[model samples]
Target: MALTTALNAASVYGAMSRLANRAQSVQTQAGGSGESGGLDFGNMLRDQVKSVVAQGNASEAKQAGLMAGKADLVDVVTAVSETEVALDTMVSVRDRVISAYEEIMRMPI
Candidate 1:
């Protein structure tokens, strides 16, 4: 049920599309060219996810080194903590985005 709700509340793309359209209009007006300088949300999202995956891999390597008695405990702790923080931040952002989407959907257009 929760999964369905989350899936139904996926309005972030709509919001991003509106924003991108606005940016494109402004760029076309200011630059007097057909090209829009706005960034792609899909690419940005993918890049951020890749960065988190890289951090997670680094953290895993640190833990492995620690187990081998070749790495400092401090470094291992830092890497794990950083990964946890990043995950927490991403989760928080996701929740907020979902909430915003739900709110927008509730609005009468």
Candidate 2:
């Protein structure tokens, strides 16, 4: 049981990293020219939020299809698992960012 749980966690983290790498690649390509560009934090955060929402919607759709006898149980499970991983990654990042902000606020400068 422990081994199974470990593998499951590893798989989720691997999926999360792949998604993060893909997003990073797109951002790099967009900012490559460096002539008409700079990173827009607002847009970046908005895009990430949109992606998470879309993943959630897709997972819900998969669940609905399964209930309607139009989808495979495995597929629905995979969709839901992927959405869960994405959400976990986002929460971890948020926590780290908040911690950093708090640390800066406490600095003597």
Candidate 3:
């Protein structure tokens, strides 16, 4: 189980690295200035959400493969673990964002 978790974490790290690389390439192509050319939080959030959805689909695919005897138990387990972790992380981020927004709304003028 610990090994599975570690492997899943590594996969998440790889995904993050890929996203960062894409963001950098996009920034360069757009010729964004240092101030206005920084990564957009909305785009990053959308990309991460898409990544999480893709992971979920992958987990489902692995399960189907296991059922068809085309995938190993370990592979299915790892995919599911990765999906679960990604979903949990996304949910946590969403909750924190909401909390922060609420706090800001409650602040004085």
Candidate 4:
């Protein structure tokens, strides 16, 4: 189990590194300096997850406020809808990433 975990971590790191390199190359080609500029994929994903969680929390808070007669129904509905969309987008990205990983694993090394 430890070996599998290590391998998974290494694979994710390698993929992120490759993506960062590609982004850096594109930026360089577009007349931008090749500085790191915080193009870390893991950090980006972490930030996005945090944003999604915040959105969900806000949506719940809005619903609670509506229940307490302190918020409008339209505001609650909008918050809930936005949260749903963000969650759905995150799930879709996860599925695609998993699918890509599986496909890569199936490839001959």
Question: Candidate 3, 52: how far from true, in Å?
Answer: 0.4
Q: Residue by residue across 1-109, what tens digits does model 1's lDDT show?
A: 8346333323432343455466556756665544258865544654555555567668778877988999999998898778668756766876998999999999999
Indicate whether candidate 3 or candidate 4 has the larger TM-score: 3
Model 4 C-alpha lDDT per residue in residues 61-107, reported as the tens digit of each score: 78779889999999988987787688678779889999999999999
- The true-versus-predicted C-alpha distance at residue 3 of model 1, in Å, is 27
Worst 10 residues of 4 by lDDT: 5-14
lDDT of 4: 0.70
Q: For model 1, how big is the CA root-mean-square deviation?
A: 10.7
What TM-score, over all chains together, does every model reach? 0.65, 0.65, 0.67, 0.65
- Pairs clashing in candidate 1? none
Candidate 3, residues 1-109, lDDT tens digits: the string is: 8568546755765665566567667867877534556877856775787788677767777877988999999999998888888878987997999999999999999
Q: Judge candidate 3 at residue 31 and give its lDDT.
A: 76
Name the top TM-score candidate: 3
The residue ranges of model 3 lying beyond 4 angstroms of the native Cα positions read: 1-35
User: Judged by lDDT relative to the true structure, which candidate is superior, 1 or 3?
Assistant: 3
Error of 4 at 23 (Å): 22
Q: Residues 1-52, candidate 2, lDDT per residue (tens digit)?
A: 8457545644654565566567667768776524347776645754775677
Candidate 1 wrong stretches, greater than 4 Å: 1-36
Q: After aligning candidate 4 to the native by TM-score, how far in Å is the CA of 57 from where it should be?
A: 0.3
